[model samples]
Target: MTSPDVLDSYAPVVAEWYSANARDLPWRRAGTTPWGVLVSEVMLQQTPVVRVAPAWHEWLARWPTPAALAADQPGEAIRAWGRLGYPRRALRLHECAVAITERHGGVVPSVLDELLALPGVGTYTARAVAAFAYGQRHPVVDTNVRRVAARAVLGEPDAGPTTTAADLTLVESLLPLEPPLAALVSAALMELGAVVCVARTPRCGVCPLAERCRWLISGAPAPVGPTRRPQTYAGTDRQVRGKLLAVLRESHGPVAKDALDAVWGDQVQRERALAGLLEDGLVVTPAPGIYALP
Candidate 1:
């Protein structure tokens, strides 16, 4: 665990740096509603900001509120998602909107527990909306925040593969007492980790926490284990899934199963991918031989 002294020292510096350096993302702008922030968080799960920006704008324009989205068919959401990589997230967002409309009267809930109770809104996302959207004093820990904490506070080269209860506690200890200030600090820490204390190649020279960073003071040791390899996309089941989804998204109505089969040559692999999509609720079979996005 990081000492209280260290935690106190880190917050103001990072928050000040973020005030001057944070990206001009639309969701971060003032007056962005809770729904907009929620949409940005969901779209940013595995997709890059560059890709998510235009898509997010389009999605909000088409369905500006939870009620608007809930009224539309889920398939339209999937179609609008448009190569965001994880189609499941699109379905999850659709379901989330439906729940938000029905449960909260079309308003995005500000409380953490209420956000979590909504479909597809996990711990990280819930905290994010509560802090960023509502300006509550919660630790919004994501991969970036975790990595920043591990290196600056723990002297580790990087964070663990997944976030744990300990990670949340460690980050929460770093927040300021004031709710709005603490939210600013949380966003700052995330921004520092993302653009400065990045994985593989940290730009320590420009990092606000560089002078006090434990990893830097300790001579920046490398990670202990073998490095992880980048994920492959070609010829994988994910690739097959994308191909199948593309065919479905392009069509206005249900497509023939044979049309989907024509996408990939490996019939077995193709069939398995289609079945996975069906099971995931991203695809629906309206009839014996027809397939479509849902």
Candidate 2:
């Protein structure tokens, strides 16, 4: 565990760096609501900021509030999801909106437990919304934040594959006593991880914490594991599913089974992908041979 003094020393440096270097993400804008923050967190999962920005703007323009989104069919949400990929997140957002509207009186809940209870809001997301949206003091640990913590505080090359209870405890311990300042530190740590302490190629030359970073002081050793290759998208089941969903999203009504078949050549793969989409509730068979977004 990093000593309290060292951890305390890290916050201001990282937070100052973030103040100057953080991206101008729309969700981080001064007047963005809790609903907007929640939406951004969901869209950012396994997706990049560039793709998410326009989609997020369009989504909020169409459905400004949870009540506004809840008033519409789930298909509209999926349709507006565009090519952001992982269309199920659209469904989950729709469900989350409905829950927020019905249970929380159309307001995004500020409580961490309440946020977690919403559809598709996991640990990272719950803490993110609580800290970023509500400005509550919560350790908002994501992949970037985890990596920063591992390398900077623990003197490791990288974090474990999954976040552990120890990770949360360590991060929480680093937070400042003030709720708002702690939130700022959390955001700063995340920003540093994203832009400076990135996984493949860290820009340590420009990092604010370089002098004090444990990994840098110890020679920044290479991670001891086989390098993982990026997954290919072409000709995969994921590609087929995206194609099928595209057809459905473009259509105002149910699409014929033949329409989906035209997108992918492999019948087995196409069928499997379509079946997976149906199972995931990203698509619905409104008629015997026609599929539509649900």
Q: Choose the strongest candidate by TM-score.
A: 1
Q: What is the lDDT of residue 98 in candidate 2?
A: 96
Q: Tens digits of per-residue lDDT for model 1 on 38-92? A: 9999998968899999999999999999999999999999999998889888898
Q: Write the per-residue lDDT of candidate 2 for residues 2-115, one digit (tens) a residue.
A: 678888898888888888888998999999999999999999998989999999999999899999999999999999999988888999999999999999999999999999
TM of each candidate vs. truth:
0.97, 0.97
In model 1, which runs have C-alpha deviations exceeding 4 angstroms?
none
Question: Local error of candidate 1 at 275, Å?
Answer: 0.7
Give the alpha-carbon lDDT of every model: 0.92, 0.92
The residue-level lDDT of candidate 1 at 189 comes to 92
Alpha-carbon runs more than 4 Å astray in model 2: none
Which pairs of residues have clashing backbones in candidate 1? none
Worst 10 residues of 1 by lDDT: 1-10
